[model samples]
Target chain A: MTTQQLHEQILQKKSFLCVGLDPDLNKIPQHLLETEDPIFEFNKTIIDATHDLTVGYKPNTAFFEAYGIKGWVSLQKTISYINEKFPEIFTIADAKRGDIGNTSSMYAKAFFEDLNFDSVTVAPYMGKDSVEPFLAFENKHTIMLALTSNEGAFDFQTLETNGKELYKQVLETSKTWKNSHNLMYVVGATKAEYFTEIRKIVPDSFLLVPGIGAQGGSLSEVCKYGMNDKVGLLVNSARAIIYASNGTDFAEKAREEALKVQQEMKEIINSKF
Target chain B: MTTQQLHEQILQKKSFLCVGLDPDLNKIPQHLLETEDPIFEFNKTIIDATHDLTVGYKPNTAFFEAYGIKGWVSLQKTISYINEKFPEIFTIADAKRGDIGNTSSMYAKAFFEDLNFDSVTVAPYMGKDSVEPFLAFENKHTIMLALTSNEGAFDFQTLETNGKELYKQVLETSKTWKNSHNLMYVVGATKAEYFTEIRKIVPDSFLLVPGIGAQGGSLSEVCKYGMNDKVGLLVNSARAIIYASNGTDFAEKAREEALKVQQEMKEIINSKF
Candidate 1:
């Protein structure tokens, strides 16, 4: 998806909420488990209910990969379903993948061409060659992990290097990479304060902020610092919204939870711009 | 596989060579394309031919994933084939995977518990929660990307932080993580000099050294600096060995290439002690 298209979708939906479709077998509604593919069934229902309220859907590959081939089939089905039905909804393959030059190219082909995701999250430890292949795909965004929401983020991302933080260096060096216009960044909502520095580096670029609801990051704090003129913040809330209820009306409950966040996002955008 | 078991296998094979099985559709023999599953067929032949010579087999996941669901099925069959046929050899899933707490757990289950890989490569960008989950698996190895061979490794890995290199910080901090015993590292063979310092922090840990043959790093240089008292190194050679020939004698040619590396490794071990 192009930057203009993504921005238009955000405005049209009146929300920047990117619903995270990380469905766990044990966490989904018990009724869906009896179906041929419970994960897809859950994601399909969630997408159907909340597609209009959100601008994007991110299905973290780890959730699908845990079940082996059967899980991968469900993952393919979910992405296919979304692309066919909700074409406007930006899809992200939250597979934090990176490797050598040729190997990274294979990964680029996997998520972008084969599975057909608009974006894939990548780890930046390996640097340019690993990330360049992902950026090589046109209209496909490479969401490099800058400051992750996890505690592990502190291990290397925040370490001071040459008078700047590691994540800052990542944002700086990434700007020089090929096709960097398609680049996006993953800055955890937990580190809302860091957005001040992050926005200074890549003001126009989109930011995929995870760790809002379940991970205890405040949506208001994230929007205050991370939001750009185009409202360039895809604030993701997964477990808190999707697993809002374990009852039969799980999808409906998910919509209610998403709408609440969407309403908050709408207010944030209105107040900011 | 346990540390002792892997060490014994290394000693028994008289080589620390880890043959990389990364089969590409266009690169494999043309006749294999006529088979039911070309990728698996290629992998099966390679494994059958070179299983005895190498102590480990590292399957880069991107090569399989680029082909989609069928590719994933091929990966499942390949791993199952390795485990069933050559239980003695250590298997490394060269899937550079890492994520948040629960998500990382899912990846751990996917590779270790589900796919049954003896070890899986993880990117250290995410930090503690991302890596600790993989370490949670008993007798399973978590080979982390410390100093990669590619030019990108220069990006964030070698950056100076706290009066130490970033990769050095990773080594120092990783020692304090839970289940540090399960930890191995990926220090690229291209930078053999870094091994001197890396060995200081992680003297006993097995380093899965790549960038040996095709990537243009000598095995002698890597072993000189990388080897531990346990003869700790699983030096990988992928394209140089697997794509040795594309004819009917492809497997035989692969063995010839692997045998050459095996003999070199045998000499390294003999001369080192």
Candidate 2:
């Protein structure tokens, strides 16, 4: 989906919320395990329950991959379900994948072509050749990691490279790449102050913000600095929403959690616009 | 397999050659397409042909993931085949995956426990928390990217951070992680001189050197600079050997190419050790 279409969806729903579908067998409801494909079933219900309150679904590939082939099957089913039922909703494959040029093309093909995710997250360690392949695909977004939410983000990302931080260098270097308009960024919500600095590099580009709720990031703080004129922020909440309740009413409880975030986002949009 | 066991195998074979299993449907012989699992069939033949000459097999996950569920299944079968048949050979899941602490744990479980790879490649862009989980695994090796073979490696890796280059800081910081014994580094063959500096920080840690033939890296130069007392190198060649001949004699021709590399490695091992 184009950024314009994503912006339109944000306007219609009044929520830039992208519910992260990071389902784990141990954390999910016990009763769902009896089903043939518990992961898909859990995701199906959660997507159904919260689709109206969110603009997108970001499924971290590690959760599915941990279960082996069965997990991959569930991931495939979940993605297919989202695309078919809610065609307008943006989908993000939060698989932080990057390799050399040719190999990265294969990854771009897998996520964008085969799985049909609107975007896939990429690591910037390998630089331009690693990312340019994903950008080559028109309209299909490549959300590169700028500043992550985890404690590790400080290790190398914040370290100064040539006068500026490495991530700032990353954002600046990325804009010069071929077909960079398709670029988006993954900036952790915990660093609200960094958004002010981040905006200076890529003013119009969208930022997929994780680290709210469970990770101790404030939605309002992220909005205060991160939000652009188009509301270019996908504030993701995974564990705080998805694992709110593991009982039979898990989906309903998830909706409740999502609704809370959506209400906050709606208020923010109402005030801003 | 432990590093001790891997080093022994390298000594026994007189070749630290890691045959990279990157099967593409378009590149593999047309006749294999008739098989039920063409990717698996191709990998099986390659493993069967080159197992003796090589000490390890590094399957680049992108090639398998590109095919979707079938691709994953092929990957599973290929790894199982290598473990069951050539139990002596070390295995590297060339999946450069890293995420936040919990997510990285899931990926470590997927590649180390579920997939049973001896080692798995990880990108260090996210830093400590993202990598320490993989290092937490008992005997499994975590090969972090230092200086990659591609041109993009120059983008951020060579940039000065603190008093040293970013990649050097990666090597130095990685050594402080828990279970640093399991730590390895991916230093691309294209930059042989960088290996000299890399060796200063990680003298004994095994360096999984790619870019040998296809990427224009020299084995002798890498050995002169990178190789430690225990022969700490697993030089990888993917396309050069595997895609040697796409005809019916593909496996045999692949063996021939591997044999040439093995011969060169044998001479190096004999002279050095």
Candidate 3:
């Protein structure tokens, strides 16, 4: 999935919300615990409920991975379900993977060819060889970590480097890498103030914005500076949506929360253009 | 595993070699392709051949991830095989995973709890919340990407931040994070010159050094500067070992390469103390 297709879907749905599937086993309903695969069952219902309201589904790999093989199976089923049922919805393997040259190539194959995610979140610390492999895959996007939304982000990303912030330098230097046209960036929603500056460096690239819902980042504040002409933003909400309820109504409540975000997104999209 | 355990193992083996399991499908012996699971078969043989010569096994997750479910299954088998047969050998899920606080906690659970890897490579872009989650796990270590081995690493890692290099600042700041006692760092062997400087800040921390062999980094130079009193270095050799041969003798040739490294490491270990 190219960014262009993502833009068209946003236009069609009038929403830019990306529901994050981060299923914590402990937080899941007791009813699901009775099932053969609680994670899969929970995810199936959530996808069933919220597929229409959102343009994307971002499954943070860690949540599924915690359960070991069972969690991984659930993750595969969730992506396969999204692909088969909601082909138009963009899918992200929120696996922040990055490594050296040869290793990065294999990672590209894993996420792009094997798991079949539209994009995968990657760390930029290893630089081009690590990142370019993900970008090399045709139509696949690489969401590089730019300005993250955590307190530690202030430690290094925002530290002044050569009279400029390091994240800003990451944004600027990444533009020169091979196949960078396929690049998108991960800019935390909590760092909304940095968006104005980030936008100047990556004027046209898509930004995967997390930290909006459970992380307490304001939707309006994120949109105020992060959105571009093509609605270049995928605001992800995990706990606030997926774990909205601990009962059979979990999926429906998830949809309700997703719907609320989609409604806000509709307004934001309308106001933008 | 803690750096202390790793250090003890290095001393006992008289080798600091961390043989990287980055089995590229195209590079594996053609005979293994006849098997139902070529990747696992190849990895098992390599592990069996080199287990005694090496102190640690570093599996780059991308290699297994590329093959899809089968690849991940192979990874599980490979790691399980090591754990059951050679429990003393340190295992690293060379997965540079870093994300939000909650998301990172789940990742920690994935590698440490589910998969049972001794440690994992983590990106430090998100700061404390992203990295601290991994460190929080008992007996599990987080190998934070500090100075990487890539052309573009110079672009950001070397950038001066308030008079200190960005990588230097990362090392200094990481010390203050919660549960930082378990934190290790990734210092590319290619950047051997910086090791003397890096050791100044992170004296006791273990450094996972890649960029040997195929990447043209000198093992002698790396040991000269990177080695601490505890042999605080895990010098990794991936392509040079795994792809040592494309014939059925691949395992034997891998053993030979691993032995050479072990011999060098033995000499280094003897000379250092």
Candidate 4:
């Protein structure tokens, strides 16, 4: 998906929220467990409930992968459902996949061809061979990790080299990759201050910002430093939305939570326009 | 598996060969296509024939993911077969997953908990949040991509910052992550020249090196620069080894290729030790 299309969606919906589909089997409503595929059922209801309020849906691959084959099946079903039903909404396979050239090419086929996600989160650690393959696919974006929202994020991402943080170096270096125009990055919401510096490197590229809601990051703070001319921020709220409730009204609660963020995004986006 | 166990197996077999299970359906033996699961059948034969020579089996997840559910089922069967028969052999789920804290924890559960892989490849772009969750798993190693073998690898990986390559920064920064003692790295064989520099920062960590054989990387040069006191290199050969013969002798031919690499590895080990 192009940044322009994402910008259009944000304007149309008046929202910049990206709801994350991270359904934990144990945390999902008990009633869903009775279904043949509880994970997909849970995801479908949430996608249905909040599709209009958000510009994109980010499905964390690990949740689906945990159920083994069943989990993976659910993931495929959920993605197909989204693609078929809400064609305008961007879909991200939050897989963070990267490998050597041939191996990475196959990954490109898996997510872009077979499964048909609009983008897949990739790791930039293997340099460009593993990452550039993902970028080669037309219209597909590669979301590389920049600054993350974990205690250990300070371990390496914040380390200074040549008077610049490592994350800054990643952002600057990415600009040189082939088809890197499609490159976006993951900058966690918790590190709101870093966005100021990150913007200097990638002023226009979209940022898939997680760690809002459940991770205790302030949404307003993120927008203060990270907002671009296009409102280039995909703020994700996973557990805070997917697990909002564990009862029959689980989907409704998810919508309620999504609506709250969407409402806030509307204000933040309007202030910019 | 731990470096000690991997080392012992390498010494016992006199081989440092890691056969990559990048089972391309189009490249499998034609006769195997007649089976209930052609991919599984192809993998079974290859494992049976070359199990003695190889200390590790690295399955690139993209091949299985490409076929959807059927491919994943085959992967399960293949891994189960290996674990049941060759319990001592190391298994790597070359998945290269990375994400946020909560999301990454789930990925760790997917590979380490559900799939039972000894190690899984991870992208370090998301910083510690994406990487630390993988490290949190006991005895399971997180193989971060340090350097990769591909034309585009030069794009971002080699970019100089602070007079050091981005990959060098990744290696140095990764050392500070929690449970990093269990961490390994993926340094491409084609980038053998950088191995001497890589070794200076991470002399003790095991490296899962790809890009040999079909990738045209010289094994001798890699061994010369990449090997450490523990011979900490798991050199992977995929297409060249698995597709050595696309006939009934495919598996046998795979063994032949594995044996050749194993013999060379033995000589290298003998000369070094």
Best by lDDT: 2
lDDT values, one for every candidate: 0.93, 0.95, 0.87, 0.87
- Give me candidate 4's TM-score against the actual structure: 0.92
For candidate 4, give the lDDT of residue B134.
Answer: 88
Q: Give fnat for candidates 1, 2 and onward, in order.
A: 0.97, 0.85, 0.87, 0.69
lDDT of 4: 0.87
Please identify model 3 stretches exceeding 4 Å from their true place. Answer: none
Could you give candidate 3's per-residue lDDT for residues B167-226 as a string of tens digits?
999999999988999899999888789999999999988899998998889999998888
Two-chain DockQ for model 2: 0.91
Across B61-97, the per-residue lDDT of candidate 1 in tens digits comes to 9999999999999999999999998999899999999
DockQ, candidate 3, comes to 0.79
TM-scores for every candidate against the unseen true structure: 0.99, 0.99, 0.97, 0.92
- Pairs that collide in candidate 2 are none
Candidate 2 per-residue lDDT, tens place, A80-175, comes to: 999999999999999999999999999999999999999999999999999999999998999999999999999999999899999999999999
lDDT of 3 by residue, A7-29 (tens): 99999899888988888889989
Q: Which candidate do you rate higher for DockQ, 1 or 3?
A: 1
lDDT score, candidate 2: 0.95
Candidates in order: C-alpha RMSD to true structure: 0.8, 0.6, 1.6, 2.6
Off by over 4 Å in 2: none
lDDT of candidate 2 at residue A155, scale 0 to 100: 92
Q: In angstroms, how far off is A251's CA in candidate 3?
A: 2.0
How many angstroms is the interface RMSD of candidate 2? 0.5
